[model samples]
Target: MRIVEGIGIAVLVLLAALAVLFLRRLVIARQGGTIELGVRLSTMVPGRGWSAGLARFAGDELRWYRIFSFWPGPRRVLTRRGLAVERRRTPDAAELLVLPPDWVIVRCINRQAPVEIAMAERALTGFLSWVEAAPPGESTPETRPYRYKTG
Candidate 1:
């Protein structure tokens, strides 16, 4: 009986810790200019797939935090330079479980390496604009978000 009681207490402590971590993420995400953009780690393997997470915009970089991680730091930092969006695709039905509904997955180059990020269409436009926007004294070609043809 003592062993079982100890195990129950341990489980409750772990649950409380997890709840605290989740609440911390929510507070950080609620900060100004912080957007709840869903992201997924890209896999090059033909059979292996992706892992989803949430990203927060910090300054000029998008800091990707794993959804299940308790760590406070980002797993990956996506900067603006050398960030080329290769393509965008709508998520299929099965993917909906991993990604938000109707969100588009954007295949992009993160400093020469390929990475896939998923977010809402409007948020993607904002992301693209934020990434392409030039800094002071730097010349950048004007960019516009892509629009798909609909009938």
Candidate 2:
């Protein structure tokens, strides 16, 4: 049918455009010698699991940009305030589907909302240090690492 053919053509065109857009984002995020590491991020929703992508630590905020997204800027910016590290866990079937092998998940609360993100162990250490480091003479509850520890 003409209508079916038209629809298929439209879908193919859209996929092509999306592919180009995402590739542009990938190139842009890696510019200026920035360290863009692969990471998986997700909310605490039961059915909704992690979305694997790239993360670049830019100053006080951790910039989260999805891998397949067309947006040039980060979709989410995680700050130290209201950020709490929950626990580490091995990826389940759903997460394993997205994350890379040997990578571990670090669950945390981002701005009062529960979030889980996965990265390499070395990157995890860097993230913890980044979250714990505080500015001179301005110590807030968010800067304290011990607050995130659970019994």
Task: Please report, in order, the local distance difference test score of every candidate based on alpha carbons.
Answer: 0.69, 0.66
Clashes of 2: 0
What's the C-alpha lDDT at position 75 in model 2?
73
Whole-model lDDT, candidate 2? 0.66
Clashes (candidate 1): 0
* Per-model tally of clashing residue pairs: 0, 0
- For model 1, residues 31-135, the per-residue Cα lDDT tens digits are 655555665554654313556566777777888777677787878788875566767888767677667776877877655477777788878888878766747
Highest-scoring model, lDDT:
1
Output the worst ten-in-a-row residue range by lDDT, candidate 1.
142-151
lDDT of 1 at 76: 79
Per-residue error at 84 for model 1, in Å? 1.4
- Compared with the true structure, model 2 gives a TM-score of 0.68
